[model samples]
Target: MVPLLVPLLLAATPPAPATPAPPRLDDAVPDTFSGVERVVAVGDVHGDVDALKEVLRLAGLLDDKGHWSGGKAHLVQTGDIPDRGEKTREAFELLMRLEGEAQAAGGRVHALLGNHEVMNMLGDLRYVSPGELASFADQATGPETSGSPRGFDGHRAAYGPTGRYGQWLRRHPAVVRIDDTLFVHGGVSPEVPAKTLAELNRWVRQDLFPGNPPGGAANPQGPLWFRGYALGEEQGAGLALDEVLKRFGAKRMVMGHTTDRDGKVRTRFGGKAVFIDTGLSTGYGRHLAALELRGGKVTALYREGRVELVTPVPPPLPIAPKQTVPRGQVSP
Candidate 1:
């Protein structure tokens, strides 16, 4: 019996090493291009699908069934398509679907990343609605030890490196140049002016991925958060705004982080900077509007089919300091 005994330990096998995940795709495409005749830019959707659809319809970008109908025109949504509403998934899915449909139709859909998009990707779900969480439940899965499926976690995963939407979002540029105009979710700051559009987008991609400190893309003053051009003090801010425009070589910068009090897209810095947030989300009362650029002209398009020309005002200059004199002494 002892001679016939076998060593059970010898039959054991070591587990196979895991295959490493594939490298993140460089989805960031060219940030600058030309030859697009018409560009329709919308702002800060914030999960209000109805408002988004209405504005797109007014801009002639969407059909009644929520399909792309813009022909060869380009549609750019300047970020913030999540948070503050329950229909976040609906809005995201529509944009995701439109990207392909528009491209097939010889048009393009640019869904730039907003601050909220960055926040959700990085696990900040403070403003995420419960309904939004429930919407993604079927697609969410977690460890058996973890009780219910995490909806926000699922939503986050859907935009993660392996997620479909995440990959699509990654492929987009934070700053897109259509003809002579620059469209971004927020204003570009002075720090990164020297960077080419490609370089800026690369920095953003790195910031968005894990293991790097989020900078140019997610910082408070980065392209996704800067408000100086929209809400800065009138004097020096205008000069800064001009410098930003000069750096990008753009005739004007169109952005959507700061909503105007009247919920109307407004121009500042002598029309060099246009703020178009216009509270398009139900959280902001659904101010449906879009900025249309065509034939070297810019017009504000509202849901009611009214259009207003956007005229740039003169950029403000620094106030010259008055010559001072010693007390009781007059200047020569």
Candidate 2:
């Protein structure tokens, strides 16, 4: 009876989570950047083009005319830019244009993949708005066709693998490491198989296409859907969170899937993880904010003022050398 009870208890207990090693680096991969002086990250547009614009301006990344003005600084949009609101098309167009402009200006734009993007690719139109569908109508169809939303075919084509937006989005990454910080649409979890950044990106790209069979990498526990850092207790998940960051050689992780109720950028686990999804779309909360990382410090930028989240500790001053008196020189 005692032996049988021990076996049952072992079966009921869950296996310990797997810890991942640091990912291999590839010079050809664009998912990582270092030595960047400044990085501004925003989250979850939900097709609110105006809200997107407001946050860009707030971060000083965009000009009044919507041109890229961040100079050499990098701008990271942690995904969920489509659905809910009506201006997804315009939002994509703006991002596409800014990508080239920022590159020309010696800067970069990293638009990561969110769960919503994969949903759209998988034909999950649950959150897509009617106005969003109408926004894709061909110009030649005129106003009458636009009112009736005759662009379902066009909308489908545009999001198809061969379409403009689809092709562009497929080439974008799911996670990026800039300096010592990691950015992704959702938080990374330790429950899944250990994977390098390149492997993660390749898997996401493969699953986005129509013909490929799903490998379950896009499941709820994957990088694009995990909400542990945002909703889970640090005392329970803090050790696992440290392992996730270590796997990527990152000091911290910044994500934007789960929206905070107060619409402010919040940190967990002594600022090891940050949540930037302020629900910028009017549908969720109309609040606006962006995360700014510069000069070894982290700040949350809002319309009202900036709040410092992490500040660099100054290095200790070198000790002064003591002088030895010569044997003959003595007392004076």
Candidate 3:
């Protein structure tokens, strides 16, 4: 019986896998950039993927197959990708794909946060079209009527804080500086409390997420809604615009949100600001347009042709009076 006794064997438990570190917030929402030689600024897709494609192709950014063809050219989309049209999902998906492709090709794609985007995130669906909602009908988890597509719930979920599209939108900055120009969905307003570009960017990004009590970006004069540069007179808003430019060290600002009456890209404040929103979406007459900046020259790209914008030479900065040292006195 003693010889039959055997020692018990035990198995060792494996260690748990380590949890991955969370991504840095700043890395996702950068405020400034430089040394970009070529840039294409397009405004307000508004769920019109076809019009967006045409503008991108005209800008030499998209190939015939709708893929990113710009080797090193940066593309700045001034938001409003959702609402007002049927193909909102399609438009957002295209931009999302192009963003990665452009980056891999040594270029960049910037999709700024517009008032509409913030509105959707905050449950404001006034401008959201029924067709746009139907695009997400298949993902709806709520009850569906006999003849109606149950997309309201799905759309809300998609734009929720933890949703994929919501996460992507949250990563974008409200304003970004590339080279000497600033690109924003809405023009910068001097009324905002934030002074520097960095502070403004932070302010908007903070107001975009859940449980933030949303301000600034949603304010009438905030970066996402301000029309001072686009609508205010040069005498009143021009001086404020200059101060904003000086504070940010940017020579000019490019923006969307206020569509041009003639559906053309127009510059304001003596070429200190460019408005690129030409109502490219179907709901706005499907105008195809984009702004091209290359080699320090601004060109407007249209479905018909291109036009160069001549900017005036900026006045020199004021120099302080020379401090002279007294005779026989040493200057420190």
Candidate 4:
């Protein structure tokens, strides 16, 4: 009987490991999307709604009435929609409205989280202007006194976890992959190269909630605050950049934390890194610059109909080779 049992156990196959379920589209952190004919990315509105609208119009994204006109083009706003200006509330409202409109038109509005957004969510109001605070007064009931606990308390309440904007903002990703390009508020740091996009986003989202430690989402070197790509040494930084791109399987990374020294949309690392924050906010005199990706080409679109081709960076060597997928096809 023992010999027979031994034979039966040896013949039985071991159970296969359970496969982890793919993230649901609604709850995915770094939302992976494909099949976009064009991509328009704007950086750091900083509460400057006028400049945002003008830039969108220049890119043929928004209509005269500020409606979604870019039929199937993807619109990516690289965070910092709040702070340093007075129209933060209005800026949020406009993006919120356009999000629905864009989707209905077969497009998408990917608004990645920036440091200022994280600050606001965590109760840091140093940059919250009086006008911005008053904008939400009517929506929330609170004392009207200035500098009091109740002052701007209404705004805070409206932007808290239970608030409309807060709920919407929570759903936004810290990093997103559209086609083969990566979009993030700040540059990715060395510590982040090992994590997958989904893991990176999941950690960030978890850190955003209250009572969490001050590392993942709030650290200076985190995705929302890291500037290594923008200010690092060429050779070393290029190596780090290669690792990040390889990890995410993206050809290029588009970011908006650091403004270009020349106040124009520019690329570094031979075009592996594109900086779109031309300081378009009124605080920066409304630079009115944006980055457009279409037909496998990158272009810098400026106010007054100025268009220039952005030079492409030579593909990094000895890492994962860049993969180019045809339109309407998803890359493996």
In terms of lDDT, the best-performing candidate is 3
Output the worst ten-in-a-row residue range by lDDT, candidate 4. Answer: 20-29
Deviating ranges (above 4 Å) for candidate 1: 1-28, 143-150, 311-332
Give stretches of model 4 more than 4 Å off.
1-26, 142-151, 304-332
Where does candidate 2 stray beyond 4 Å?
A: 1-29, 139-149, 315-332
- Ordered list by TM-score, greatest first: 3, 1, 2, 4
CA RMSD of all predictions: 12.3, 18.5, 8.5, 16.2
**Model 1, 80-116: lDDT tens per residue?**
9988888887898899899899999998999998888
The positional error of residue 239 in candidate 4, measured at the CA in angstroms, is 0.6
Question: Mind giving the per-residue lDDT tens digits that candidate 4 earns over 110-212?
Answer: 8888999988878898987777766667656555666564337677766677676777788888889888899999988768633688778766766666665
For each candidate, give its TM-score against the true structure. Answer: 0.82, 0.82, 0.84, 0.82
Better of 2 and 3 by TM-score: 3
lDDT of 2 by residue, 1-332 (tens): 88899989999999999853322222134888999999999999999999999989999999999999999999999999899999888888999999999999999999888998778767788888888877776632234434445666667667776666776777788889999999998887876554677876666566775566563336888889988888888687888889888887999999999998798999988889999998898998889999999998999999999999988879999997878888889754
lDDT (tens digit, per residue) of candidate 3 on 1-332: 55444332223445679854432335446778889989999999888889999889888999998899999999999889988888888888999999999999999999999999999888898988777887776655566656754587778778876666777887788899999999999888877777777678777877665465556767877888988888887798899989889888898999999998688999887788999999998778888889988887898988789888854458999998889999999988
Q: Rank the models by lDDT, top first.
A: 3, 2, 4, 1
Candidate 3 error regions (>4 Å): 1-28, 141-149, 311-332
Candidate 4 local lDDT, residue 218: 80
